[model samples]
Target: MSTDEHLDPIPDSFILQPPVFHPVIPYGTTIFGGLYAGKMVTLQGVVPLHARRFQVDFQCGCCLHPQPDVAFRFSPRFYTVKPHVICNTHQGGLWQKEIRWPGVALQRGDSFLILFLFENEEVKVSVNGQHFLHYRYRLPLSRVDTLDISGDILVKAVGFLNINPFLLYSPRLEVPCSRALPRGLWPGQVIVVRGLVLKEPKDFTLSLKDGTTHVPVTLRASFTDRTLAWVSSWGRKKLISAPFLFHPQRFFEVLLLCQEGGLKLALNGQGLGATSLDQKALEQLRELRISGNVHLYCVHC
Candidate 1:
């Protein structure tokens, strides 16, 4: 996993948010779109200087009396002589056998970036860009909807980001890649492109085309002028111009969500709004072509 220096001070209105969060402890929020493989939960915060212990829980619900089931409980304790991390589940009001990892990676007063990558059968945890541990699922992952963080820690930001679009078998895909879309465009399907802009980027374009070499839609990110252009062939028109999101030598995740009307665009988890294209034009899209200044990491539809 690559780290982006620009990722900190996340965008104010991103799908992955609790942006500029209130410095209050015991933070809780709904995991928008729920838990799924390739989804990432990111938390940026610092451990309180006097912190004794803190826990992050993924729960099925937020019920009080009976207490909703906790699919995953990740707790780090400072009171212990070794300062270890405990991972377990709470089901039917009982705690399951715990798996303890001695020596917590996080230390008091240290600002940290924690990422939880959800996989089919487990969650991979990373702290400050280093692999921390893996916690296998004890309960059905689909049941997780809420994220709860309690105890002593200062939270800066939290984000629920989607990546790897359709779960490619290969970890990454090469740049200037082209793929055929046999079924054309379908509503609810998403196209995700993750990569790093070149040190001196010129521009990049992600386009959808038909067999006759006609491009129906193209999203062009221009570093020269720092603008994102939405191009369409329906009327040979440029739909709109959005603020350029890609930065030279920075990691970026671009998401294009197919909808009945058009595609919803998001950059690095921040929703950039949408554009409307004809459904008939979309249905004729048989190819996805990406080219220009980037080191591609992954691309899936």
Candidate 2:
């Protein structure tokens, strides 16, 4: 997909589950870590003008002959006289009682959004933001791991939104992104940045700034000096010396943990070092700015 199509801007305040873009029809893929209560699945697509029917199946597995048990089958039939939606489950190679909701809200030849929200007891479905129906679980939700979609629909994107506090995930985020720190910097909070260094790298910096636009803390990864430097309003305290991990064409994750003393730093998952900051200064921070030679993937606050 083109960069423009993939990096559609979303507000930084709310974290999102990474979305799948421009997938081919009859698509089937394993859910990242499987579904759980409070999780949601979103599908964006257009129904073919002459489409007869289409179905989205949440299956235990993509087995063929034995026909893996289907946790949920969401089908929209355009071939019907009045048009309607069908919900059902398949287990032991038998189809369960059909649940029908008449009067389909979807229109052919137009874009649509389908949301499947998983709850502890049932799956709530919404069509283009309107609540449509609910289906109670027959098979264990834990057994559902694969998503299979087929039929006459022009699929655009499919996204999974996992519930997490102060976290966000985007398959791809535009570089030079700045996000707000709504709760400000506080003890016991963590900010994570994941990205790839440009092939021909230059200095890249992640900075925390106050509402007044004054930067209080900044971490710079310099290729020329091959060092990671921590700088703040006080001074450039020290540099993370030799064998720096931020290299050209390499993937890296930088984590900053706010603590009582200051901030704990980590490169990838390993401890890099720590920096001390006055609680007053950390509390004043309101935004995070990232710039220079990096392609961002996800950012969590």
Candidate 3:
């Protein structure tokens, strides 16, 4: 899949997370107003250690009723003939020719994130942030009213995010700045920062702090120390190699995903940030400050 298939960072509205369905096998749920172009469904979970097979289906009607039409069936098998994943359509309870994709990206006892983004002609699927498959619409997209996932897997979260709206694509902003997060620092929300390092810079810091007092959680990338560091008052500060040393003048983007435990950080796709962001941090997190020697371009929280 092309990078264009991925959802944009600046969102007019956020994803709507539905309640997780645990131990869901042969389980199904209604897709409100039916599925459509520009609608996206995301699933995150773990593949059981002893997993045999799993299937996620988008259907006009579920198998609970007879003769249900399955628009898209994503069935991945582990102990199958060749251990491959198949994509197919089932109409009038009859199956179509299967399209096979090799390589089982999900191993036993591993977690995975799956995203299905619908477009006019096809549904783009990505597994663990990597493009997995794309299925052209043999049946009308609007006919898909229910989503069903069955077989061996542990379900954690299922959510929907709309990409049809014209969310304000916040252009670049000035650096050495303190800016408010788009929707405040809430769990499930994401913060995206884009910028370039200054030539011969010693360091730069990105801090998220409370509105009033400056009790802050800072991520500092230092050339002098030759490390990318993380610091909060409580947890042990984490430091690693200084990529900025050779990356000066090169553009970069950082993404922060707020979770229950803490803020999970990523540069491009590499994991960063280490520390538990406690209740106090959530209650007070209000301002995002960027300082030091860097040219800030975009900050979309």
Instruction: Pick the TM-score winner.
Output: 3
Displacement of the residue 19 alpha carbon in candidate 2, Å: 1.6
Tens-digit per-residue lDDT, 1-301, candidate 2: 7779866565442343445667899899888667667567878789999998899999998888899899999999998777799999999999999999997788678678787889889999988657899999999998999999999988877766653222235466887889999768899898888777889987899989998998888998888878788887677557874236576875566778899878988664335568888898888889999998888878888
TM-score of each: 0.56, 0.54, 0.60
Off-target runs (Cα >4 Å) in candidate 3 are: 1-15, 18-23, 168-207, 211-213, 218-230, 233-301
Query: How well is each residue in 87-189 modelled by candidate 1, as lDDT tens digits?
Result: 9999998999999988667888877777788889999998876789999999999999999999988886665666544423324467789989888888988
lDDT of each: 0.78, 0.80, 0.72
Model 3, 191: alpha-carbon shift in Å?
Answer: 9.7
Q: Order of all candidates by lDDT, from best down to worst?
A: 2, 1, 3
lDDT of prediction 2:
0.80
Return the number of clashes found in candidate 3.
0
Output the better candidate (1/3) by lDDT. Answer: 1
- TM-score of the candidate numbered 3? 0.60
lDDT (10s digit) by residue, model 3, range 1-301: 9887785564433333333435356678987667877677777778888889999999997656686888998988887655678999998778999999888587778788777889889999988767888889899988998989889888866666554433224344676887775345777887777666778778878888776746567887777856787877455577753233225664455667888878876654344444577755765788888887777666776
Which candidate number maximizes lDDT?
A: 2
Please list all clashing residue pairs in model 3, or write none if there are none. Answer: none
Rank the candidate models, highest TM-score first. Answer: 3, 1, 2
Error of 1 at 38 (Å): 1.1
Report the error of model 1 at residue 15, Å. 6.8
